[model samples]
Target: MISHCVFIRFRPEISRARRDALFAEIDALRHTLIGIVAVYTGVNVSPEIGMDKGFAEGFIVDFDNAGSRDAYLMDPGHQKTGARLVAAAVGGGNGILVYDLDTGHCLVRQAR
Candidate 1:
């Protein structure tokens, strides 16, 4: 599985409703796209100060594999959604960060 994480710094002028709508559009992709296992959206909730570095909201998409992820990237609907996100963000492209992790390396160990 591939975990696609995107951190976003929304512009102050962007309304909460817009943010919600954007995330909604993102989540809606799962229905039309193939190989999307799950989609999770959230705001930074950690108590540690400054840890998020002003990136308060974001979403994670779990894809069955890298191919699925790449396909989504090229999807026209996603391109439009990404353009909307970039426009609403603080510094256009700079306001977003994307990271992908392979689940194969993730090891879960039970407590001793």
Candidate 2:
């Protein structure tokens, strides 16, 4: 599995409603796309304070493989949403962070 992690620091001017709308748009992609294992989005709810810095909101998209993940990245619908996210981000683009990892066996439950 491929984990696509995206963290966002939205500008203060961006309303919660707008944020929710954006998240909803992303969630809707599963209906049109393939190989999306899962999608999760929410605000930071960590016990440790200040650890999140300014990135209060984020989303995770689990893909079946790199091919599916790449296809999603090149899709026009995703590009549109990405543009909106970048615009609403604190520093336009600097406020967003992305990381993709190949979970491989790490995601498996080993018998201890």
TM-score, each model?
0.95, 0.93
- In the range 24-62, model 1's lDDT, one tens digit per residue, is 999999999999999999899999989999999999999
Q: Could you give me the TM-score of model 1 versus the true structure?
A: 0.95
* Top of the candidates by lDDT: 1
Q: Which portions of model 1 miss their true places by more than 4 Å?
A: 107-110
Predict model 1's lDDT versus the native: 0.96
Q: Each prediction's Cα lDDT score?
A: 0.96, 0.94
The RMSD of every model to the true structure, in order and in angstroms, is 1.1, 1.9
Clashing pairs in 1: none
| Candidate whose TM-score is highest | 1
Residue range 1-112, candidate 2, lDDT tens digits: 8999999999999999999999998989988889999999999999889998889899999999999999999999999999999999999889999999999757576798
